[model samples]
Target: MRWKHIVAASLVLASLSGCSWVNKLVYRIDINQGNYIDQTAVEELKFGMTKEQVKFLLGPPMLVESGYPNTWYFVQYLKPGHDAPEQKELILSFDNSGQLVGMKGDYQPGSGFFEAVR
Candidate 1:
């Protein structure tokens, strides 16, 4: 009888642990829905623009590549729980020489620009 109780208690504990794991998975923030830039802005980037100029034009980039001074990155993401899917990305090669090199864009699940939020 004591062994039966122990087994039942163990099963309860196991189920509770499984539930916690499932909750964590379900509530996880999808880091993808945060994109605020669009393709028109990307297309407007010119090779001779300075960093300050770029900031003025497109606001700040989501990331700036370290050790690569000339590299600037702009990224937008949408997470799954939200109205859209999350985005993960990298932009390469912006230099102080007033030259833009190797600018790139990446999107997942679909390919297109996310309309600016406002």
Candidate 2:
């Protein structure tokens, strides 16, 4: 009877442990969504840059709701086969004249953010 219990326990443990290796055998492609902005691009942003200028640098934003025309949202989501998924966001606020005035979210503004583009 004790031997039967040991076999059952071993089977249960094996079944549980087997899942991890089985999962590894399957292939998973890395998934990337939305704009992929690098640090250099973020560093190029200037305080008074126009919407067109910002667009030229960072490309189109992920979200620009109709209700919030002055606010632009840049989002990036990355999922790897065997690693944790990562998400990044950048929110830019513009003035009534469509000039960049504020920036927020995961990314930090560059040192030249205070300087206007010539």
Candidate 3:
């Protein structure tokens, strides 16, 4: 009889442990909001594009390069899960000449800001 009680208690503990594991998995973080800009549209911007043109094409950048009126930066981020590293950042830079100079961060052409151009 004592062995039966022990077995039942063990089963209960085992079930609770399984539930905790499942809870951890189910409770994972989900990032639903953040700027989802198209990078391709940003890339398509030519060196000669005016600031107005850039604004029309990519919308306002997430953050502009500090103290650099001629430079512009576009950024975006995605944080999907707690265990999963946050997928973050897309950066596009334009030079003082009003031309695209450097681009870094995740540049998914179709997935990013350039989709609207076509």
lDDT of each: 0.60, 0.92, 0.61
* Candidate No. with top TM-score: 2
> What is the per-residue lDDT of model 3 for residues 1-118, given as tens digits with 9 covering 90 to 100?
9999999999999987776566566655666444566656745655445678878877876676568766555545455655553554655566656655445666544333343332
User: Per-residue CA lDDT of candidate 1, range 1-118, in tens?
Assistant: 9999999999999987777566556655555443477656665655555677667756777766577667767667666553456565647455557555455657221122222121
Ordering by TM-score? 2, 3, 1
TM-score (all chains, Cα) for each model: 0.50, 0.84, 0.55
Query: What TM value does model 1 have?
Result: 0.50
- What does the lDDT read for residue 51 in candidate 3? 70
Flag clash pairs in model 3.
Answer: 37-113, 38-112, 38-113, 38-114, 39-112, 39-113, 40-114, 41-114, 47-99
Better of 2 and 3 by TM-score: 2
Clashes of each: 16, 0, 9
Residue 31 displacement in candidate 3 (angstroms) = 1.6
Give the runs in model 1 whose Cα sits over 4 Å from its true position: 1-35, 80-84, 88-92, 107-118
Model 1 has an lDDT value of 0.60
Q: What does candidate 2's lDDT look like per residue over 1-118, in tens digits? A: 9999999999999987878887888999999999898878998898899999999999999999999999999999999998899999999999999999999888878899977763
